[model samples]
Target chain A: DAGITQSPRHKVTETGTPVTLRCHQTENHRYMYWYRQDPGHGLRLIHYSYGVKDTDKGEVSDGYSVSRSKTEDFLLTLESATSSQTSVYFCAISESPGTSRYNEQFFGPGTRLTVL
Target chain B: AQTVTQSQPEMSVQEAETVTLSCTYDTSESDYYLFWYKQPPSRQMILVIRQEAYKQQNATENRFSVNFQKAAKSFSLKISDSQLGDAAMYFCDRTGNTPLVFGKGTRLSVIA
Candidate 1:
């Protein structure tokens, strides 16, 4: 198991409020990604970071923002939470293709957020 | 864009029996990767198996094996000696230069 952890394992916020979730990894992997899991959707990428201060949007980047100021930490923020944004958010880390060609991401436990 | 499809929403297998879950993907690129991930009741995502497009032989890990057909763009997972612990939601994913595209998932049940 990769040494990855997500903060605020569970959170609740009212609609129109701001919320943030944090992901930390001890492995010092170069790739970090944020995803969300909903009832009908298995998992959708929200954002990804290849390095500190470098980030890109994903398939479902609406209503979400992410920042990676450090190698070990990636933050996902919801400027104004909406009911549709309530879902289980997961953080993943992966190393670039090197000696081992299989580049699979290691996931954190995940953060369950609810918007009222 | 790549799209992964899991036709079976749910499936069941008796203890000790073997079962196969279906996954099909559409992509224009030949160099890519296919993956199967298991999410048990704990919601932990476990990498069951992965297949590299360049590899002709199917990828196998213990009881988990994948039947990958490049022509048909199909990748199916076969589980042998099914145990209750094997029961979980299975997701099929595909990736190349882009982020992973996942199927909705198939709920697997193992009956004693």
Candidate 2:
């Protein structure tokens, strides 16, 4: 929902190859986030962006990088993909948090990525 | 640091019955928020309910309600009059100044 879309809903990449996942939102929200979901791990934040050209690392930022060049787009890049990097990635968007309104993060459908 | 824990890995509930999923969290901060998110087979994360730490009253939404005990650091979701459509993976989450920390999740199966 929230007018969010992820490209290549399904992707397969070879280990050591570089890969990128794209997230786009039409709601013009100021906050965008990238998360990976795994069994027993729930969802772990990979990286998040607060505004255009502003980003920060998350709990699991070792193998992930993100960039927000525009208000609607956020990209997560894997400089060198590995089998351990394969997981279902979800993108979420939220308006200014700490406010009572629009604080909920609406998630995208998710992308299933596999690294061989 | 904030951490969420869902004790029940899986549970089953009969149609038209009620079921409760347990969640416990650890946080030192006094002000924060907790949320319940449902991920069905489609894998889309849907917000079910939210509870503010400062509020004593439990949060409710139709058939869904939460038993939030701030002192106990426990937040549990109760689904009454369950429907088959309610079957999904439910995740418990907490957030303060940082991003949300989620529990592993509880898989709920609604039996007909």
Candidate 3:
């Protein structure tokens, strides 16, 4: 455990409803990312933040939004949940990209989200 | 676009046996990084090993080592003396300026 916790470890929501998943870290890492895993797709980056209030979209950013108000917390929100959004979501953090260490991503326990 | 391909969808190896999982990636960038991540049933992602594209020597970590063939665009992981704990989904990944691009993953079964 990297002192990372994801709220609502398991979430079940119906289509057209709003849902939010939270990720909290105790390490004060500067970089945070949200990824979703599905069969045959491996893991796809949904969104990532390099600093507070600064975020970027990843390969699969559509249908998902993210916010990082503080270094310790990053939130992923689905404005209107859809069945296509059902998957296991994972949160990862790493040292800033240029600080010498690369490819060292620490992951959270993961959240299983199901959309009906 | 960068893509990673893990040919083996499922593989089984007996305890104390050696097994190799194949991974091939396609990228135009000459300088990048390759990685192997393990996900047990627990669903936590663990780093197994990593290889810098510029490095010719294969990276090794205890019981886990990689056979990195840069010319062939292949990076395979070999686990020696397999243990039951080795059973899990192994994912091959690539990273550069963008986030990592992961392969579909190979489910490895360690039979006792």
Kindly list the per-residue Cα lDDT of model 1 for residues B92-112, writing each as its tens digit: 998778877889999999999
Q: How many clashes would you count in candidate 3?
A: 0
Model 2 misses residue A99 by how many Å?
6.8
- Model 1 TM-score (2 dp): 0.97
> For residues A16-108, could you state the per-residue lDDT of candidate 2 as single tens digits?
999999999999999999999988899999998989999988889998899998999999999999999989999999886533444688999
Worst 10 residues of 1 chain B by lDDT: B93-102
With a 3 Å backbone cut-off (N, CA, C), the pairs that clash in candidate 1 are none
Model 3 lDDT per residue over B1-112, tens place: 6789999999999999999999999988777888899999999999999898889999999999999999999999999999999999999998777777889999999999
Clashes of each: 0, 0, 0
Evaluated against the true structure, the overall lDDT of model 1 is 0.92
Comparing 1 and 3 on DockQ, the stronger one = 3
| Ordering by DockQ | 2, 3, 1
* Runs in model 1 lying further than 4 Å from the true structure: A97-100
Docking verdict class for candidate 1:
medium
- Cα error of candidate 1 at position B111, Å: 0.4
- Tens digits of lDDT, candidate 1, A1-116: 89999999999999999999999999989989999999878999999998999899999999999999999999999999999998999998888631236579788999999999
On a 0 to 1 DockQ scale, where is model 3? 0.60
DockQ of each: 0.51, 0.67, 0.60
